[model samples]
Target: MIYVIIGILILAASFIWMEIAERRIQEWEKEK
Candidate 1:
């Protein structure tokens, strides 16, 4: 059960990171 919770947290964090990275990339493209 603890492992499952940890896995979910990691997945959530990675998803958020991906979203942030995507936004940054878009901003960079606009700047260029």
Candidate 2:
């Protein structure tokens, strides 16, 4: 059970990080 919770947290963190990276890329492209 504990492992399941940890796995979910890791997945959520990675997903959020990906979203932030994508937004930054979009903003950078607009500036160029």
Candidate 3:
């Protein structure tokens, strides 16, 4: 049960991280 909770948290964090990364990439492209 604990492992399942941890897995979910990790997945959520990674998803959020990816979103932030995508936004940053877009901003960078605009600057170019």
* Backbone collisions counted per model: 0, 0, 0
- TM-score for all models, in order of appearance: 0.88, 0.82, 0.87
Off by over 4 Å in 3: none
Q: Per-residue lDDT of 1-32 in model 1, one digit per residue for the tens?
A: 99999999999999999999999999999999
Q: What stretches of model 1 exceed 4 Å from their correct place?
A: none
**Clashes in model 2: which pairs?**
none
Per-residue C-alpha lDDT of model 3 across residues 1-32, encoded as one tens digit per residue:
99999999999999999999999999999999
Model number with the top TM-score = 1
* lDDT scores in order: 1.00, 1.00, 1.00
Candidate 2 regions off by >4 Å? none
| Model 1 vs. true fold: TM | 0.88
In candidate 1, clashing pairs total 0
